[model samples]
Target chain A: MTGSASGLESPAEDLLKVQDLLVHFPVKVPLIQRLISREKVVVHAVDGVSFSLKRGEILGLVGESGCGKTTVGRTIVRLLEPTSGRIIFEGRDISHLSQSKLRPLRRRMQIIFQDPHASLNPAMTIGRAIGHPLQIHGIVRDAEEVRQSVLDIMREVGLTPEDQLFDKYPGDLSGGQKQRAVIARAMILEPRLLVVDEGVAMLDMSVRAKVLELILNLKRRHGLTYLFITHDLATAKFLCDRIAIMYLGRVVELGPAASIYAEPKHPYTQALLQVIPTPDPDKRRKKILPRGEVPDAIHPPAGCRFHPRCQSVLPTCGWEGRDFIDLLDEHLSTSPKGVEDDELLGSIGEWWAEGFEAGRKTDAKDPKKLVERVKEILAKAPPAMAQAVQSVEAKGEFVIVQFRTPDKLVHTAVADRTVECLLYQ
Target chain B: MKAKHSDPKRASSLPEIPLPFLGRLIHPLIRERRSLAGALSWMGLGILFFFIFIAVFAPLLVPFSQTQPFASPVLQAPSLQHLMGTDNVGRDVLSRVIWGARTSLEIMAIGVLIALAVGFPVGLLSGYVGGKIDRLLVLIMDSIYAFPGLLLAALIAAVIGRGVFNIGIAITVIYIPLYFRVTRSQTLSVREEPYVEAARALGAKSHTVMFSYIAHSAIIAIPVIFSLSSADAILTAAGLSYLGLGLEVDTPGDWGRDLSDAQSFIGVGIWWMSVFPGLMIVILTVGLSFLGEGLNDIINPILRKERS
Candidate 1:
């Protein structure tokens, strides 16, 4: 762990370390539901995610929605309790600390939420909202000192006319002003680690850059360590010193921002980079687009979770009967000239990976010709899919396609990075 | 996160620009939900103050002792000597009615204060630290709430024995469930709000989060509930007294007991006995209801904003 922390001769030292954090939320069911369903269902929101933050470093956790990037940020600040993990902050394990025990440590770590509108109490005035931490933590004993400090911090956050805005409620402020107030409140305690969960995603385009700049300025001023969670790659590139690209509740790639942008290692990271629409239309950048939607976290792909959608997928990248069906469907959707009315096509939706036997009631005059046409179509498929197909035969008017059992791709070290693909493994 | 249609320049100026304290208090009354709040404030304040004044200065107005009877005619009608006439025992009916204000106020004050004291903290705990404790509290409160309030008060009063303190205790029992339910429900929602999470993130302990973040927001409904519950308490106390579960029969100036005594005199055309006590109960309850509704309009910003 110490060797990993000192990987590079960086000036700053490690401030926070998180190891193999898993947060699963049990789906609440009534007693009758529990009795009827023998198995307990849990949403694996964050599964085995781990990363560390260096002092004065901005580590962006970037992923698509439901990738559990936000959960990683929240769990670090102890906002959301991890099911099991080692969250060593300043060399102390505070992962499973009680609420009372966590209270004092809360002053050292803070979290700013995405929606400024929903982040401040509507009932409390701006002054009280910002000063509440000071009062609660006994940081400032005098009310006058708290007010003066609140006004000073308010000005620092660019909320001018602090005296006038002091008594105003959250509903009274605009989006940008509300965010500034929120930032002021979060920073007044001078927290060392800040978990910003999509903090600027709710602000308008005009104010986004200014807010981002303000964040950078604050980081420089206070030497703050940030776990910045966001889905926008562009913003993450601008603000994050280092970026961790997450996929299906795991960090697939973690490196410096410059290196990642220059040459992204993971397939998922490469696909995410391609998503940013280039302004220069003349330069047609070759995009490596993932094939389908993200797999469900509850039942993630057996090998690399990104394997189902990965364009750089190998034969051993968890390819199963469903993968074969997807390829068949894709081939048919594009050409479907011969098997346009196949009944089995619609029935593929109900089939799971565990071996299934279904017969198509076809009135085709030449079953041999149909099988030849399907074979011809299969020959044109991608090499990975083409190789996976073991058998394609016409058995009594039914065209059967059997795929080889896919070997699970295990994670292996490629250079300094961890890559979960057979090509690298 | 869509920018509202309102200009940014103006929206920034909307909340923080301070108005004078007096103006801030009066502004909502003038503009937001004007007609209803204004009418209620005037009527309710008028009646409420009238009762409060009577409660404070009952002795100054009453010519004779409230509990003891006078040497005047047993069933005297309205006259210059005995204003509003006299009861069947020759006691000045007006004196007892005036003094009834003090007794009614005592019940309202004791019942609400005790109910709030017991209900508020319990509700706050049940909501803020929800789990087995919350389930247990909800079960207990619901069980208590399931019984008809008046009947429960009567049952409690029967066990506690007939006295002013017993009456207040019985009324408190009925009102506690009301406060607990309201506070718990309000706390449940407030606890989930991001602001509460923000407070927790700011190093606030459990008690601080409960009282400062959750309770502070949840307490807005309290003034409304307090006024409304006072009205409820008045009726429940009167009902208990009328059912012989409240103050002793010999205790004079109790509106419920007075009403019970007035039943025999109604046949003899002694309308003053029933009319004054009944009107006092009606006026006080109406006053409290109006005050409660008026405070709600002022306190609930959503309702105030809708009207504006």
Candidate 2:
């Protein structure tokens, strides 16, 4: 443990440690599903991932979407219970502590999430959400003092006129504002180390930069250490002091962030860098779409997980027959940014929003007639909007309204942030 | 090993700007889903509520305030005086129908509350703490579920001596397993959600973890289970009354007794006596199912629809 309270020379060595962590999920078949159940298997989401950070040092953990980066972040904060691991914070292992024992220590370790919306409780106002950690840690008992503390944390996250944002629900806040609320909640603890798991990925590109700047500024001001888990090598480079690239369930490379990006050693690390969308159009030609789809976690390949699809394949690379088709499929899927989803979701949200707004403004003369008219308006909307609106209308009608679609596979990495594939080999 | 200076001034733990939602004493329930314009999804729910309105606020709706008809002949057929006709006791079937709403509905609702009130905390503690506690709770619930619910309800009814409250208590005991299973499964899933972890990271106690993060997630399961158990509750209560072991035989406003009493008169072909009470039960069950399902879907879409 490098980051203890007694006194170290720099913020970079205050201490963050994870010892031999493991998390395995059980997948079982119902009696009817037995024939196809094949065999009971465990999806080892995280296997023996261990690393540490100093008081203010940023330890960048980079990997593809399912490479367990987020799981590792959650586990360190004990958000996801480790099958067997030790999380040492400020030189004390909190692993396996009873909930009672963990309570006081909780204020010392906090986390920021990828989806600001999902991470926040929608029913709570942003200020309450931020002040929650303060209350839980018993930082302020007096009502007046809690309010002042919340406003100050809000300012640190860059929300203006702190009073204005104090009353907004997570639903009302914009992407950046929601992210700031999450940060405010985590920071209220004045935690020594913050686990930020792709915290800015959900924001718009323009807003993302501002949020990232706010984060870096907070780090400087508080001397807060960070365990920044991301798939984006570029963000990792910008935010981390040191970087560790995970593949399958293990770190394949570890070094200073600049060196790992500038001079990657592992084949997975090299491939990830080569795929970065280079600004110099000439340099763009070198983009290497990763060769294989991320294996279904429940049934991963044997021996060196990336070997099956590696162009740098060798007898030692763990190449297998299924790897070829998987590689071809990957090449096909990455030809161009697949159809942009922003436009579709935006159009649908807009249509539903308009319909609901109109529904509210409709004269009270007859709700039935208003509903019928709303239905007609929805039928005439654009295709995506029409579907979204229809669903919204049926909402509270046939069933409670829900618009959950399949969680699409996203290229979560921004620039040279990932360390999967084999181009850097 | 190394350490860093603890700088109190730089804690900069203060907000950079304002936070809007702070200082609220309570969390507001998100009024996210509006119901079918409250039009009443099923014909049964409408009819059930109509009858209830007549029973509770009878003077307002019905032209005649008398719930107890003064002069109706035994086994009488349908007429203006006795819309559903008279039972063997010579009481108005329609009055009984209106009054029966209070009895059956109270049983269903109270039984469910019992299941939730008694079973929820047990299920939560079992799943979250796990180990010996989980096994002990599981053993008790598994034994309860092992009994055929109706027979189990009958046994409890028999033991408690066939009264209205006895029948409901019996039903509540019989159905505790369903609530236990539903709640335990939900807690198992919710305890793993990220926010629960986030809450724990903030030093939230187990009680807070149980009620705060997991409860809402667990609550979505409530409507679905309520819908499910309401169906069970209605059927079991009706079954017991029909069997002569539920709701004391001489009790007024008994739908089960109405049905059972309707049995011997069948030869005379006065079917509306049995048909109306049976229909009332169907409506209440179906209405509850639809409303509960509708609520669940709005609150937690993923549960309503699972994808590959």
Candidate 3:
């Protein structure tokens, strides 16, 4: 009964393949302001991310908030349109398909949201909420049949006293009951692929384990494949078959669940795994904490986005002129007495940085004096940054500081696994 | 734990005011809000039901036929024989005012129904589709909304010409934008709720999502608006008739037209002709408004949830 419907298709084939999917949101500006500036800004979310899921596989997309894991799941289900890239589901490219064309495909895939209170309509009774999807997809026509099927699903999701809870609204139920009802709504149609987006994140800790167990039981019973999105690595370890670590909208590392936990290749993945507390008192773990906050996606750091905070950074780590500008700004703000000229101090923000070169026009009396002064400033940089700074020279009235450019880290094989870092390369 | 337990005792030292049984009966209404809107609503409903009774049994209750001319001495003052006295045409003023209830209620109820019928679907489409069609319909509704209700009613009345049905149409036009604005805005917000999105994600057709999820949830506030709009409808219809733009001069029953005819007699001290008709208008409108306010008390969960 479980595999009879989809047995003809090869089990070894990929169920869903995503290639370089990008979902960028264009920042809206006032009409007059936009016309005068002629500049278009966009939030680079879910930039150049790719992954594939096989049938019966539960792939976890784990990352911090705003890492675009949720966006990736939404794009796969066609909830949010992708700005670019292909999403091949069951060998069909559904990347840019129209809503009408996607309607039939929606029956095969479903999404369970995090907040169960918000996911179900407040005005609708629990019975109607669960059974409505069945009626909509033409799986059941009669109201009584719909009710019986909904009750069956409710029982399957561990919601008992089905008769007592049938006519109750979402407001009447507890947090766990609400979530169980939400799961019943998603599973009533028996979709092939379910995208669970932090589905247990909002439930109580006591109820979390039970709901997770229920999800696993349902997956096995129905032979359902899942693309589980969560920030909790512990839950992902318990649930996901394969884990992909996302950093600034890119899959920095991906492999089997056990291997990622035992030996994380990417610095970002290692930092995440290190934070999990172990119960053993004798073993003191050396925690690798990344510096600073996740940078704004609008102006992501040049080269590798994690390079600015990477503990194992190399001399060629994707540092651009902006890095120099940031360093200069920090120096000026901390100790301002070194620079006396008001004009030069006021014009420091006018410095331009791109690629590996950063420069600013100076109003100095002599070019040689400005060159000497710029070199003195570069000398005060930390040892790592000082080594990366190749040269400082004054050309006419412009002082240019250049840094050695490192190669961008593509997905490189690390033994049996894959990682995106200069160290792995 | 001991300090927390003593806090309630300290707060309870202030004496509590004892409420009467009637006060306790309506306690839910005033417990959280501290508003007179609830009290006024009950008063208004009482006035409205009184007129509904008058209108329903106008013939049986009246001493004389409202349409019969010279049934009594013209300019007769209030007496046992004539409770509200006679009009300028010698017809019974009390009977005419009683019969006027039927006319006013008909225009108010039917006109609001017409407005809701026309405005709801248009608002749904304008809000749901939401681009060029939305912009165009919004522009048209805003133009109508810009005018004062009576002035708009007059303008529409002049074009459509006057009679019972025409006056109803005029009032309908005046209030259509109110319904459209309310329903459209409600639909706009309800369309964004996760439940509506959940329905769409389940492969529900556009119509199914619109009717089942969006419309069902969005229209909760509509009934609250409906009662209030009907009250406004009564005032607008009366205004149109007061300007001689409603029923004909010899019409048997009309508050606005009667008020118009009674104005000439106001200079002569024949107060019953004007006062009776004007008083009925006030009572009926007030009744409708109170009914609306009362419904608001029950329908709004935000107000009800806090106390319960």
Candidate 4:
């Protein structure tokens, strides 16, 4: 099923809607250190993401590891509490609901994890593990009825000879069998929405195809909707109706799967698509993989999170003090140390940046020479970075560098999708 | 299409023994026979069972009452009439030694059971509901763990006074930290496992997740700690009695009290008074130690696999 019929569906048909959802995890600090600093630091795992899914939709959440696609999926199912935002499922706000209130709603939403071996309790038999949810929710009280329901779900998921496998432990089953059992456990509750977080990533290639097919089959039989989270684009293309491309905890582009694959709008999405391997030997497609490791989430880039690694970066695309410090650090480490250069700019350690302004103490050294050295460094830097700098001035014993305020970024609607980029705007 | 039933890795390693229960019990011992720990564990099990047999049949096996005096000369040597000969009180030494097994076993069982009863739930709550409760429990347990086992037992024994149950309670105080530390650490690790999270995601309450998922997996190391601590408790119990803080004089036979009484006679060359009882304590403690070590060797690999 694809998004051919999506345009015709009314807003009333929306099954789930997320508005600016944010999940920030506070970094643990020692008590003495915390008291002295009085500064609270948090990892902006899922900064501000908004998306919606229609009924009977299979929306794929595609991103690199640590980009927070899994976090979004978890937050939707209320497995993780959102720091701020609204999660409207079936027309009710579930974002701030208490756990007890969410318990009844749990029957309508479920999550299947990546590693099946770890997701099933080693001590519990497959039958008991699968039927436990029914008992917990008090849906099926009779022992025989629970067993019958468990056996039926097992048979549906293609775990044949269900009677024999029912009494077996997780260690007794193979990887594929364990995954199928995990899926069976989730499906036995007859949930309306399933968030499959890399559900088949750990399985063999042969088993992966079978599990994907089973997922599609289950959706068809139950008319279930899915928020599929995975790093594998090919698998997403094969299964998803819509695709949302995430980079550094934000969705850069979101649209129909076929159109996004055929013509990616965002630079990050284009870079991701080029890295996917093709079978043909004669076609040597140029790979444009992004450079540098992901920046720490504690202090993400000021403007667009992906601007640091974006190949098509613009002057207005959110570059700040941290980026300048990083560039200076790179320059200092590689170039041979000059006595004059060392005298003018004491060390990289003395330099500090916040927002668009970066300052370094002169310490009685000539401020004019420091300003000149900074300008000289900027001359050789990337054109976009150099153009973004507004001025460099010397005042008292400190040299200050100021960058221009970037153009306000927003999710602009392009041809058939929404892209958060200056190029689209 | 029917999926092929691959044999479970654990079941295949076990030999095809007739009795399922006995085979399961002996499987780890047989598998680990090549290791020194395994060999020692087997010897320990044998010694432990021998002592257990004596403790169970103390009434039938003893030749005289544990405390009664007879019309025989004191400090008599080994003979057919007195068997291992009479003590300084004109009582049979063999009967007292045989009866001491029952006392030691009683102290061990009660002491360890009490420690487990108090320590397990406290640890489970501390580890599972971690934060302030965890920090508080860890502080308390660490303070208890800092004290020497005998010294702590002695202090408690002195305050609680002497008797079988009181001595057991005294010994229990020394080991509370051991069980607490083991269970708490195990719970802390198991709480992070994916299965525990999965159970929580399935609408299971906090208590349900703690007991069913976390507790089930965390309990693997408890048995290993149990046997080893039982061995340690035997020593502490005897030490308490030796210091004259344990059972009353002329009560059912106790090794520590007997050892204490024999100390004054040892210089006069009455070797029988101390040798038999001392030998019994050493054998039982060593047996328990071997059992504990062997269990560690067998169970540790399984725990490691579970973690991975």
Name the top lDDT candidate: 4
Residues A1-425 of candidate 4 have per-residue lDDT tens digits of: 13523543454567789999999999999999998997798999998999999888999999999999999998999989999999988777899999998898888889999999999998788999999999999999999999999999999999878998888778879999999999999999998889999999999999999999999999999988999999999999999999999987899999999999999999999999987888896896878888798888898898888888888899899878877888888878776866666777768999999899898877755577778889998888888988898888987777888888888889999988999999888
- Per-residue lDDT of candidate 2, residues A1-425 (tens digit): 33544553444544778877888787765777777757667888887666677677889889989998888887777766788878877767767776676677777778888887777765467787788777776778887899999999888788877997887667668888888888888888887778889988878889988988888898899888888888887788888899988877776677778877787766777788887767777655655655647776676654456654454543333333233223223433553533442221112212221111211322234345435544544454333323432133323322112222212121123344433333333
Worst window of 10 by summed lDDT in candidate 2 chain B: B20-29
Measured against the true two-chain complex, the DockQ scores of the candidates, in the order shown, are 0.49, 0.23, 0.38, 0.43
**Which structure among the candidates has the greatest TM-score?**
4
TM agreement with the true structure for every prediction: 0.86, 0.66, 0.90, 0.92
Q: Backbone clash tally for model 1?
A: 0
Candidate 2 lDDT by residue in tens digits, B1-308: 23485466534433232322221110111233234512332333455466557557634543333445345567788887667787776777777776677678778877888988888888888888899889988999999899899998888888888766777788899778878888888889767665666677778888877876666555556655776687679888889988988785445577777888888777878898899888888877777766555545453554433110
Interface RMSD of 3: 7.1
Residue A255 CA displacement from its true place in model 3, Å: 1.0
lDDT of 4 by residue, B11-36 (tens): 57553444323443467678787788
DockQ of 1: 0.49
Top-DockQ structure, candidate number:
1
Locate the minimum summed-lDDT window of 10 residues in model 4 chain B: B15-24
Clashing pairs in 3: none
The order of the candidates by lDDT, greatest first, is 4, 3, 1, 2
Q: lDDT per model, in order?
A: 0.80, 0.68, 0.82, 0.88
Per residue, candidate 3 scores C-alpha lDDT tens digits across B134-228 of 99999999999898889878888899887778889888887788889888987897777777777878888888888887776556667667878
Better of 1 and 3 by DockQ: 1
Reference interface contacts recovered per candidate: 0.82, 0.53, 0.67, 0.61
Sequence-dependent TM-score of model 4: 0.92
- The alpha-carbon deviation from the true structure for residue A156 of candidate 1, after best TM-score superposition, in angstroms, is 2.9
In Å, residue A37's CA in model 4 sits off its true spot by 3.1
